[model samples]
Target: MSHSYHVYILASKRNGTLYIGVTNNLAARIFAHRNLRGSAFTKKYRVTRLVHIEPFNDVRDAIAREKALKKWNRG
Candidate 1:
């Protein structure tokens, strides 16, 4: 069997606070975020909307991309 990974961004509102994360199941993760079970930061900031997603065949690649995105300037 093969596995796929996802890098996703969630936002509180359009152009609002952003949350970046990697997951194997995007739907479930998004559901959790919407239900206030995703993470401390995401729940606190209300970043529940699925604003963006990137698919990757390797988990390492997905993680790397997420790390790079997190390091980006928020300006």
Candidate 2:
């Protein structure tokens, strides 16, 4: 089975940091983040925790959402 989702970024606290991503498996992805294996950015800034997530039905949609988030100012 193929699954897709538009993963989102979340700060450790209010405006503590920013993380942008997309994943087919939210649970696994979040677990990775919590363990410090999520990604280089998250690892660098220590942005671990499931603060935000949005599921999607299409990979394209997820990609688009990720791109949009990427363009946003982390401030």
RMSD of each: 1.8, 2.5
* Cα lDDT computed for each candidate against the true fold: 0.93, 0.79
lDDT per residue, candidate 2, 1-75, as tens digits?
445675777566666877888888887888898888988878888888567777888989889988988887755
lDDT of 2 at 66: 86
- For model 2, the stretches where C-alpha displacement exceeds 4 angstroms are 1-3
State how far residue 57 of model 2 sits from its true place (Å).
Answer: 0.6
lDDT of 1 by residue, 1-75 (tens): 545789999999988999999999988999999999999999899999898999999999999999999999978
C-alpha displacement of 47 in model 2, angstroms? 0.3
> Judged by TM-score, which candidate is best?
1
- TM-score on alpha carbons, each prediction: 0.91, 0.81
Best by lDDT: 1
**Which regions of candidate 1 are displaced past 4 Å?**
1-3
